[model samples]
Target chain A: MSSPEVLVHLHQKAVLLLQDDANKIEKLIEVQMENLATRKCPLYEEVLDTQMYGFSREVDFAVRAGLIEESAGKAIISKLERNLAQLYEALDQKSQLL
Target chain B: MSSPEVLVHLHQKAVLLLQDDANKIEKLIEVQMENLATRKCPLYEEVLDTQMYGFSREVDFAVRAGLIEESAGKAIISKLERNLAQLYEALDQKSQLL
Candidate 1:
């Protein structure tokens, strides 16, 4: 591969890896949201928080390493944050209903 | 730059960035070890743990992204873990003295 090709491939790979990590966290949020009323794992939130933190670190490193654009990294993280917010909102509504 | 040159440059840059992060954590450990008796920040350990987690995440991402060899990533993390263990041991001994 040429220089530009190599860089592009690396960038795509970095973004793909980050997206995979984000999807795992998204899955976690979905599971917790689905089981919000059934399985009361108190550590679910903690686990999610830790996962998000670790994933964010990965994103941050990618940005710094020039593997992906800063804007791309920010977009991925923002999307996850929005989903997480929605989950928390749903949890709040459920608590209010109870 | 040529393809090989580009790869070499990226690999070196990734290692440098990770080393910089590891050094920051080392500095944190050093500061805490120095203040092991006086400052008594109950949250120091928590902060260090969080930093270590974040740093490790960066290393893991770099390895997955193909920016660094897995062994290089492991070495960086292992060195930090050793220093961290020493700090904890010293903290333990100090408490024992108390």
Candidate 2:
């Protein structure tokens, strides 16, 4: 296959995976937030570590192929990281209350 | 602040952070992939390690809140993990080529 085709193929796969993953992550954050509010586990979810890293790989490939903007890709993952931090903060607050 | 309001606030903040973070991560992955494809780095991006773990925390919180279904949350993370695995496969393929 040509380089362009390869790029498109990779980009398409990454985007598909990304869309599904993003939705799930968004929902996961929502649930985790509720848990903190109700005073559940004080600890943060530990699964995201692998997911984020995996995502980074896809982003790297996509940018190289020109399928996605570098800044745009970074922002997508950063949002998840930032919100994750926020969740950590809320969890900390909830723990203090206990 | 009331519980619901606090939840809303946390959710909003998390969402904003998440959006930004996601973009960054996606870009990071793209770059890393290029590095690998070019033989610049035989190893995968180490930066992703921290990000994935951090994301896990958010997922944990969202799951607790009922904002995300459990299977859904797992799937989100799993997709990244799978792609990461795919990258690893590519790396392995390249190594074999060498």
Task: Point to the candidate with the largest TM-score.
Answer: 1
Residue B28 of model 1, lDDT score: 96
Each prediction's whole-model lDDT (CA): 0.92, 0.60
Q: How close to the true structure is residue B37 of candidate 1, measured as C-alpha lDDT?
A: 74
Candidate 1 stretches with Cα past 4 Å from truth are: none
Model 1, span A1-98: residue lDDT tens: 89999999999999899999999999999998888887456588889899999999999999889888888999999999999999888888887887
Worst 10 residues of 2 chain A by lDDT: A58-67
What is the C-alpha lDDT profile of model 2 across B42-89, one tens digit per residue? Answer: 334556656665565555444543334577558667766676676667
Cα displacement (Å) at residue A8, model 1: 1.3
Model-by-model DockQ, in order: 0.89, 0.03
Q: What is the lDDT of residue A21 in candidate 1?
A: 95
Fnat of each prediction, in sequence: 0.86, 0.00
